[model samples]
Target: MPKLKVLNLFRIQLSLLPSSLGHLINLQTLCLDYSKIEDFAIIGKLKRLKVLSLQHSDIKELTTEISQLTQLRLLDLSNCGRLEVIAPNVISKLSQLEDLYVQLCPIQWNVEVLEELKGLSKLTRLELDIKDSKMLPQGFFSKELRRYNISIGDWPARINGDESLRTLQFKVNSTISLEEFQGIKNVEFLLFANVENGLDELQSNITPLFNEKV
Candidate 1:
């Protein structure tokens, strides 16, 4: 079992990982999706781990220990409603990470957390949700990202778009200037929800196929 490369403990009704799991030095993929296990400290021992999925799990926080998996390429924390904290510099430590999914999670996003994402030089795909559109900093996302689904408000955003295109959706509650955001310049699909009168003010060279004004 020391040479195990994949472990699918998905939906397992366990509280903790077995101590022997640390012996799987060669493990590359571990899926705990929809599981009740919360303690992930043992996962840090898997130096070769490349993929980790905690979707719909009961984990409350992403502790510093998990950042030891420097080889991680894909991490899925989507639908982790209980997830609250992600230790500082933990995300930047995943130097090899290429894809990250945090959609539908209840974690509070701040400027510090958003800034940390910029350090992932290898990231190409991302799915994220920010509760307030005003919190977005100028030049938010990296220009190198090929595909993304980002929702910046409480409204339900349109998800239909070309898979090759980057999508950015946000709710406009007050008068605001969109041109200041350099990250939106490359966005192929954009949604401006609840914009009342000034649709022309937000227009740019990039025209969005979806725009809902009320």
Candidate 2:
């Protein structure tokens, strides 16, 4: 009989767990949010991990061993204020990953990182709330992105041109020009948060824009 891993505790406050968590080779899901975990080396060893949520944690950085979890499908590190780096190679190995949310995390949105994410053909949804918009590569929109939520300092020159995007949520102060929405078709959801009068002109032209309630 295969062994069953047991890790069930809610809202426990611990600065860091012993490295012994690596022993749970059968661990498939791990949720350590609202905890005092300042480091993430212990969870890196769970080779079978698929779902990991570290929201609102005080973690400073992610270990390179995070790439070892090749089977990971969903990873949420939202609101990790101290996180500064995300290893490119580690992100590249997550070929099977489907959903990724890194909102409010300080990750360098660079060209290489964008290229690596584009390589992950399986990623369907991505939510990134970044402080700087210039760091995002021009080709970041090339991959088969289905849903995207981004906070940019300034809108990109253009969105993905070749493929069809389903949804786009942009948190910007400026209005999006009609040219930027050229290649996009059949978009079910479109959100422009914290905008000024930029959307007034578009509101009359953009056909069937999603409701504000959505």
Candidate 1 off by > 4 Å: 156-162, 173-179, 196-214
Candidate 2: pairs in clash: none
- The clash count for each model shown is 0, 0
**What digit string (tens of lDDT, one per residue) describes model 2 on residues 1-214?**
1254536434658887876677888988888876677777777788888988888777777678788889899998887777878866888988889999887777666657666776887898887665554455554544556776655554443233223445565544433443334434444556555456567645654554333212
Task: Please provide TM-scores, in order, for all candidate models, with all chains considered together.
Answer: 0.85, 0.72
How far out, in Å, is residue 131 in model 1? 1.1
The local distance difference test score of each candidate is 0.80, 0.67
RMSD of 1: 4.2
Off-target runs (Cα >4 Å) in candidate 2 are 5-9, 154-167, 171-186, 191-214
lDDT of 1 by residue, 12-126 (tens): 9998989899999999999999999888899999999999999999999998988899999999999998997788778979999999998888777676767778778899899
TM-score of 1: 0.85
What's the lDDT for residue 65 in model 1? 87
